[model samples]
Target: MTPQQRRALDFIEQYYADRRIAPSLKEIAAHLGTKSRTRAHEAVAALVRDGHLVKTHGGRRNIAPAQIQLDRFTTAALRAELQRRETAHG
Candidate 1:
């Protein structure tokens, strides 16, 4: 993920964890210390483009992680691949 996409995902995750609800673009921008909601929206759009997130019901505040139907093997493979990538780049 690009830095912006990663930041967007991090913001969404934190927002959900904190509020138990999806945040609006304005809220996200505030959380990210951005001056404009447009920047937050662009970051969210990038996340959707990368398949890490889904926008729901044609709304700006309704976003969720992409649905994944993973079997144990597939889940493990994905986890390992993500770890490998993180380790390689970090």
Candidate 2:
């Protein structure tokens, strides 16, 4: 990840940690000291592409970290991943 992408991801993770909700594009822009929500979105899109974040459709606060805590994997998440893999390979 680029330096700016890392910064955006850190801000996003911190925001979610504090509120248990993802930050909006506008909020992310302001935190990055920019007024352009599009720029903030691009940063977020990059993070999503790089697998540092995930975005679900049809919701205002749908973005989440692919892993809640990078260091520790949760059992439920592991099960979900295993199910997805099984479905995909079957």
Most lDDT-accurate candidate? 2
lDDT scores of the candidates, listed in order = 0.73, 0.83
Candidate 1 has what TM-score? 0.61
| Per-model TM against the reference | 0.61, 0.72
Q: Residue 80 CA error for candidate 2 (Å)?
A: 22
- Residue pairs with colliding backbones in model 2 are none
- List the pairs of residues colliding in candidate 1: none
What is model 1's C-alpha RMSD? 11.4
List CA RMSD, all candidates. Answer: 11.4, 6.1
Residue 5 local lDDT, model 1:
65
